[model samples]
Structure formats: structure tokens, C-alpha cells
Target: MLVTGVKIQGRADEAQWVTQFKVQYSNDGNSWTFVQHTNNQSDMIFDGNTDRSTISTNIFPAQVTAAYIRLVPTAWHIHISMRFEILGCKECKTPLGMKNRDIPATRIKVSSRGEYYIINSNDNTSTHHKGGSHARLDRFHYWVPDNDDINPWVQVYVGLGKIVSGIIIQGFKQHWTRHDFIKVQVNGSIFESINANLESTWTHDHPASHATLMFEKPVVTSVVRVEPNDCSETTRKLTNGNQIVILDCALRMELLGCGNIPEHGCVKPLGMETGDIQGTQIRVSYNHHQSNESRLNYRGYWGGSSPNINRWIMVYFGYVVNISGIVIQGYEVYWVELFVIEEMNNPTIGTQEYAANFDGYTPVTVLFEKLVHTTYIKVTPTACHNGYCGVRMEILGICDDNSNP
Candidate 1:
């Protein structure tokens, strides 16, 4: 379908009309692309109905062809209520063949978990467990790992390559809000992170439910791993009268993708894990006495002199290239909670701010709105987690020989 525009009618109540909205299109309905204005290249916002019975219609600057279209309410008069009609011409019919379902327990694999917190078992028919370790909703809840596993992960294998758009993760039913930050890995390498800190406002009617994390780009892979970086823990008494502490708990998971891999499905990482980058090229404004600035070890990272503002780490890419994003990981116990990137590609562009990495292990990938072509870039840590400034990162995007002029 070629989606050309949208027609919306507000509710009978005049106070419940939507004032502004933005449209987004998706091929699989899981990953969405925003409709942009040709003039500004920004998300196109449509002026909505002001009264109850008025039908407001807004046309798109350019037609978008997709399987599904959604309207996001940007502003509302009092409450958001609307009846929408999609305007489009029936050209080539796009079938809704995407299958999104929970990955079976048999295909799930965890790094390590508690004795009663069974993960790999295929017994999901019953919601009740003998030890009362299962949630009322399902048996897949509460994957409590041992306290020794600082960073625990749950992996899913789909037999063959599938185009994965996202994953659904639910928190423990008995616990409050957990899983603030989680990293997604496709195949064997880190892909991205669920940057949004998800937490349910527990209630009888609205209990803790799953949060769907959509990727920036769909990945074609047979295996996908999810690791919870920062999950708060609580000591619980087991059925055997033993009290144990669970670390970085993940309750339930579901894969969100179906269909064969496309020809261009995956994006390759630029130079962090592949060793294409040298250590000596990295420069730091201030290095901690106990840390090395040039080491890329997972256990070790570049730490600032003190957990203070204005500390920075710069990387020289040898040659200019169109840099897109970055993946930053923390040291053993030191990590930066907030930082900004200064791309030397354009001096007038200044710095772009980003906040991530709730823990010291899982890498947080931050994407940029525009491509940065620069030979060197700097990152300044504005906020540190627990007053520890640590960082290790990899640059994303391809290096172009023609860009080195």
C-alpha cells in the first residue's frame, strides 16, 4: 500500500481531541520509520482536530509504501482520542506475513541461573512451580542467577537465519522495577542496547508486563543474546529455607522477528572488537593513576584522573570517514553514566550529548542523527556512575579511502 495521507476525527467530547500527531510506517510492524518532511528532513507533524466532530486531513509530502502505518500523538487538548482513516492507493499489496512470538523455552540458553530458576526447560504449560518460584502470569518469569554472575545473559537460537527487529523482556513479578539497561547481541557480537529504562507501575489490573525493545536496524542472524546490565537485586527465602541473593535477574523473553534474511540485513562494526584500531591512537585528557588509557581489555578501561566533570577521551581514526555511531563499555567497576561526543568533522556542530551504560560490562551503543566525517573525535564524561569515570569504545561506520582528501 502507498500511504499518502491520514484522516482523523476526534471524539464526541470536544475536550478529548488530539492537537498534533506524527506518522510512522513499518514493513514488519515491529521496526518503524518516521515520515519526514522533505524541506527540513525532520519528522513531519500534522495539525490535528480542534473540535469534536471535525475531520482533519493532512497529506504526506511524499508517499510511503509499507505494510502498516501508525499515528503517534504529539499533543492533545485534554485527552488523546481519535478515529483515524489511512489514505492510500492500492498498488502492490504487501502481505502481513511477519510472525512475532515468544521463543520456545527449548531454544533459550542462559549463562547461569539459580537452581529453582529454570530457564532452558520446555515446561511452560503450567504456571505453577513446586517451589513457588514461578510468576502467576507464566513459568518463564524470574531467571534469578547466582550472585557471582555479575552480568548474566539469556540467549535464543532460531535454527536458521531470521531478520530480527527486536526482543520483548519482562521483569520479575515479585520484584519492583528491574532491568534498567540491557544489551542485545546478534550472532556473537554486541549489536545495541535497550536504552530506555523500563519499569512497571505494579498494580492488580496492570501488573509487570513485557517491554518490547526495537532495534535501529533489523539483524539477520540465527542466534540472539540479551544481557541485563543493571538489575537491582533482593534477597529472597527459597522453599528449602535458604536465603540467597540474585544478581541481574531477567524474568521472561520473546524474539520479535520473522521472515527470511534480506540481502542487506546486517551492518558491520567499524573497528572496536576487530582490532583495526591501534591503542596508541587514543588520547586522554586525564588518566587515572591506577588505569591505563590505551588498553582495550574488558576488565580494564580508560579512567579519568578523578570522577569529575570536564574529563575526556579522544580517538584519532587515522583518516576521515563517515562515522555513524559508537558502542561504549565500562571498566570492571568504573563506568560513565552520561557523556557527550565532540565530532571534529565540523567545528560548528559542537558536541552531541548521550547518556547510557548503567553497569561496567554491557556495551551501550549510541547512534547519531547525522554522519560524522572526522579524523579524530573526543568524548567528555559529564556524569559518572557511583563517581567512577571509565570508558572503552568502538567506532561504527565504514572507512572511505576517498574521504581522506
Candidate 2:
């Protein structure tokens, strides 16, 4: 179970503030056990600001399994309200974590020089992983680099840029020595470093069976790299003619941003397919807004005139999908003002509409209350904020099959 965040309400008085607490979970709702961190420590204290009318805490933990979880206050001045959000599991007491946002079957390319001893050649090709199956020890299901290699690394191209927060690395339980040092990179920039042995010493407990490297802040990028480093050659090695480095290691990386909405194969501008507005300056190209780049010239147009001008573009997904949200980025000076979204079903139905004014240069997201399934979506613009209209948009959804078609 992933604990995403916590919400505390009640009085801001010092007497009601909770300074310390314990996170305990139970299988049968009777006997509860405290959740341990890297080491065996069980005490978790409030970080940063604590005195407030409302407190919002953001914490993302690796997946856990238990029936019931509750926070027991160790130190508090007065009675207050507290709420913990457990994410990723439907059967748990909290909401589910956002499912993998990366398109399934997205190509994952690794360095050619790295040695792969026990892993299958096809094991690293897919973006999806079995959730909460960290105990599996088959090397064929993991991506293991050769111990002799100086710098072994793996890279995943998400097909487009996305916001990434954390990575889960499953360690081999049998004869493999842990990867003592590891570093993560996003878009070729260093994101975080982990000295697992050192971390265990500070926490006064042994390292976990799986290593979770979480960024203090989230990053937006299209590429992610995990590099394992052998700090000392004297470390114990796995013996099978080849030195044992990581015998059977798996990864479950988490992303937090949006991805492209329309299928690349079926994307077409309003006029391009129908030859309606032949000379318009704006046209839809699937790759234009797939990244964070804010190119002033590359944009799609929804053309119309005056206060009641209506312009729209239609997109087909090839099949039905569960749409969760949409992210829109506009030109430096022109952004769509009033717009409505409709999905194609039996007769075509309007799903949602927006009338709020937005700044042209900033990115804004519109999240649906619940996921909806549709094969096609029509985005219609009713007004423009600056009389000029163009936008770069992405639809955030997953197919019913949960795979790339």
C-alpha cells in the first residue's frame, strides 16, 4: 500500500498539534504492527510546519500489504482530526494510486555494452510490472547487469516527457551482493544518489529487500536512467563463472505527469482530413506538444470569429479508452478561452465544458471527476483569450486493454 498524503484538520492551537505518531497496520483488524522504514525504527515525527489550522503532508512509500492501517498519536497537545491516504490498492481503506501512465509496450532501450547474464532479452522491453510481487526471485524476469562491467546502466524512453517521482528496485534474495552505490538521471541530469549501506547505518537497521529511491521533488523528463556502481572490487561476488552483481533485479518506476492524448497513427487536423479550411496557419501534428518544449511556431489552430466563434478538431483513439484528464499548453500570447469536450459513443455525447480564462504561456490541467471510456474525443473552442487561438494538448488515459495498440 502506498501512503500518498495526509490531511489534518481542527484547531490551530498548540494544544491540539500532533508532534509524533506511529503508522501501524493489521491483517485482521486486531493485532497491529508498526511499519518500519529503512532501518527498524518505528517513530515518525511531523516534518516542517506543524502549527496550522490545516496540515497537508506529502509522503510516498513503497507498496505495502495489510488489511487495516491507522495512525496512533504518540504526542499531541489536544484532540484533532487526522486522515491518511493509502494509494495503489483497491481493497485497502484509501484510494488507488494513479496507474502507470506510460503507454504499454513503449520501447525501453538499454546500453548495448552492459552484460545481461541471467535475464531474458525480452524482459526489459515492457513498461508494466507485476504490482506487489517483490518476492519473485527468477532472474529471467529481471534486468541484471554483469558484475565485471564498470558502469552498468538501464534507460527507459517513455515515448514522451512525463513527471517522475520515485523508482523501486527489487534486489536478488539468493546469493547476490547488493548494489552498494546507485545513481538516477532524468533527461541526462542527475536526480538523486543512494548509498544503501550508509543509509542503513544511519537508520540503525538493515536495508530493505527492495530499494526505493524517491526524489525530494518530482521531475519532468522523457528519459530515465539507473546506474549501478561497484564502489569496491573486494565486495563478495556471485559465482557461476561470472561474478554475481545483481542476480535477479526488477524495477517498478512511478510517473506523475500526463502523456499524449491522440493516437499518432490517427491524428489529423480538422482541415487536413476534410480539406475544409485549407489555408489556415495552424495544423495538428502528434509530436509537436508531446514534450515540454514551448515552440512559438509549432501549434494547432481552432479558428473562428468574434465572441461566439466555434472551432473544433476531432481525434480517434482506434479503440475505447479510460480517460482521466487532459493537459493543455498554449502559445505565448494566444490561448483557448471557452471550450467543451465530447466523446463518441452511440450518438456522440458531451462530457465536460470549461469557461475559465487561463494565461496563454502557462500549462493548465483539467482532471475528470472519474475515468470515462470513449473511442473518440472532440475538442471545441468557443472563445479566445486574446483574439488569437492555438494550443498544444495531451489526453491522459489508458486503454481498456491497458496496452499500446
Candidate 1 C-alpha lDDT tens digits along 295-346: 4334567775474556787778777765655667777777878787887745
User: Which regions in candidate 2 have their CA more than 4 angstroms from the true location?
Assistant: 1-106, 113-140, 146-149, 159-161, 174-180, 188-208, 231-405
lDDT score at residue 104, model 1, on the 0-100 scale: 43
User: CA lDDT, every prediction?
Assistant: 0.58, 0.43
Evaluated at residue 76, the lDDT of candidate 2 is: 58
The TM-scores of all predictions, comma-separated, are 0.46, 0.31
Highest-TM-score candidate: 1
Candidate 2 lDDT over 265-329, as tens digits, reads 11112222233323232233332232223222245433323344445555566566556545455
Q: Could you say which candidate leads in lDDT?
A: 1
Q: Write down the TM-score for model 1.
A: 0.46
Error of 1 at 220 (Å): 13
Off by over 4 Å in 1: 1-34, 37-41, 44-252, 258-267, 288-297, 305-308, 348-351, 400-402
